[model samples]
Target: MNQDALSRELALRIGLAARALPDTDAKRLLAVLADCTGMPMTESQLANIDLATLKAAGQGEFAKVADDVLQQALDILKNTASEKILPAVQPYEEGEMPNSVRIACASDDAIHVNGHFGGCTWFMVYQVNSEEARLIDIRATDIPAGLVVDDKNIYRAEQIQDCKVVYVASVGGPAAAKIVKLGIHPMRLEAVASLADIISQLQQVMAGSPPPWLAKAMGIEVSERFKFDREAVG
Candidate 1:
């Protein structure tokens, strides 16, 4: 079958699997699936959907959207398996050191060395070992940052310029517009707290077993932070 046809089949199979769960789980699963697929689920859509229909529709693979759904599903299954999952893995402490794995505090003004950089003014560079991000460097220039500028140019500069990722807190519209043109992924975080929580959650999710929602999938695997990515597993 063609790619589209295959995607539809996958969606259909996933829908069917979702249908077999308890009503609450099924509803939650459907919602998560819908979000991952980027398709709005109306009441009728929710009521009438079946594995066969979803497969027949040819919606295909849920790439970008699947990460959130898979994570939620795993969390639900983990909670069902053990009520202490969150607390047992909680990284926070009472008035002690920050619980985040790699946090760039507000005062530091230095971005974390991930492959994704947000905004326009600042950007990042890195080397990849087997497509895995490693040895990233954060840099800044005179250009204003954020989403307003030509993102493609920044991406090209980064690509040819030999950088893997960029991180920034603030970006403008024109700057953001410019950077996207270069095809670089931007990682935007509002505050230290938000970034810390996400990092902690990801760590908890990765070390556990595959959640019920993803156990049957072919290539699905959880990362150290509990986030799901196609290329995360070796």
Candidate 2:
């Protein structure tokens, strides 16, 4: 049979077996089937399969699909569930912890930044906070050097859900333009400097009112931080 036909047949059989079992059992069975077939089993397919067909095939016939392996996986899932060993959820803490901005610096020689922990030739990300500035995280990238800085090859914006501010830096041109189009501010800063000093300078600049051209380039606008009171999943 063709691959599609085989998949359809297997899906039909698995779905029938699943429907006859309890919710938990069905889920376990489906997981095993999915693993064996290397494909996910959808509820619609299960519903479409005729249970009578599966019954006619009988246990002996079903065993051809390695019923032992499926049963073993189901047993493991059952034991795990019965143990009640689930991840914990942590509630969101109250109060504004302060907002921080990231700065990515690159040069014409070779784009390099300080590693967060401690490593040369690494990407350094500086975070600007209201009270003080600090380094949050840094990573390593393979971007070559001597590339002219432009909207296409440098400076980008990162948008994260529930994040109040847009993250710019450690990116290239097209991505940066996309961020600006989304109404997110983008700032470009280079050279190694103390994180605190950078934040202080940024605050000073904003206090004086940004120049029209600079403000327009950065896509500056009023933004408020958002807080969610939810438990953290453990």
Candidate 3:
């Protein structure tokens, strides 16, 4: 959502819930609303909006309150813009192992894992869980093509250090070791597939029969939850 629109929506929500929110919270959200909207509003106006109205707001009406609240709260404390929501890890679906996971792909086109780690120029970071997978950012590499820098893998690894896994067309042994040392798994693929296809595959894995490496990555213990095909039993 756009900054102005986001600010307005937060303003309305805090306003509607003013009766239920703490006085300090009410004041903070109200002030942010004014700053964001560039309109003056007194505490009385904020108090006038009651809990009933907030309860009536549809889910869409308050699509991003938790995220916006944290952002606006930080902005208020720091006296920053407090309008745009900061990008952060989103909550995942219930029963989804590890709750959430972040993955990075070496892709110039942003749709496939089609680049060598050392030479790739773009990396797409995404948040993945069972219910949904969302693209968070398309980060650019600091190094340009054909530079042959000594720290090419270092640079690429640093770009996605926070990610759990990185998909690439190729990775050198030393480079792969560097990535592994940083606790990031590297997957080398001979042929790249569409990001959508990758996501579909991931969803299928989450649905059933996740392998040991995957179960470990997702923080799921290998236990009775592992289902077996009854007919296949000897």
Predicted model with the maximum lDDT:
3
Across 1-234, the per-residue lDDT of candidate 3 in tens digits comes to 122332453454454444333344566555444443335543223323333333233422333445444444433322233132222334444445344567888864443567789887678776677766766777888777677767767878988998888888888999999999988989887776645556657767766776766667677776644545433563
Please give the ranking of all candidate structures by lDDT, highest first, separated by commas.
Answer: 3, 2, 1
lDDT, residue 100, model 1:
16
Better of 1 and 3 by TM-score: 3
Tell me the number of clashing residue pairs for each predicted model.
45, 10, 0
lDDT of 1 by residue, 92-200 (tens): 3322322212222111212222222332333323222211222133344444465454544454344323322224454455545555555433345563322223333
Q: Model 1 lDDT vs. the true structure?
A: 0.34
Predicted model with the maximum TM-score: 3
lDDT of 1 at 188: 51
- What are the Cα lDDT values of the candidates? 0.34, 0.36, 0.60
Q: What TM-score does model 3 achieve against the real structure?
A: 0.51
lDDT per residue for candidate 2 within 118-204, as digits (tens), equals 112333344443443333333333334885545422232231212223323244466556655655444444543322334456656
Q: After superposition, how far is residue 210 of candidate 2 from its true place, in Å?
A: 7.0
What's the lDDT for residue 11 in model 2?
Answer: 44
Q: Which whole-number lDDT from 0 to 100 does residue 68 have in model 3?
A: 48
Q: Candidate 3: worst 10 consecutive residues by lDDT?
A: 77-86
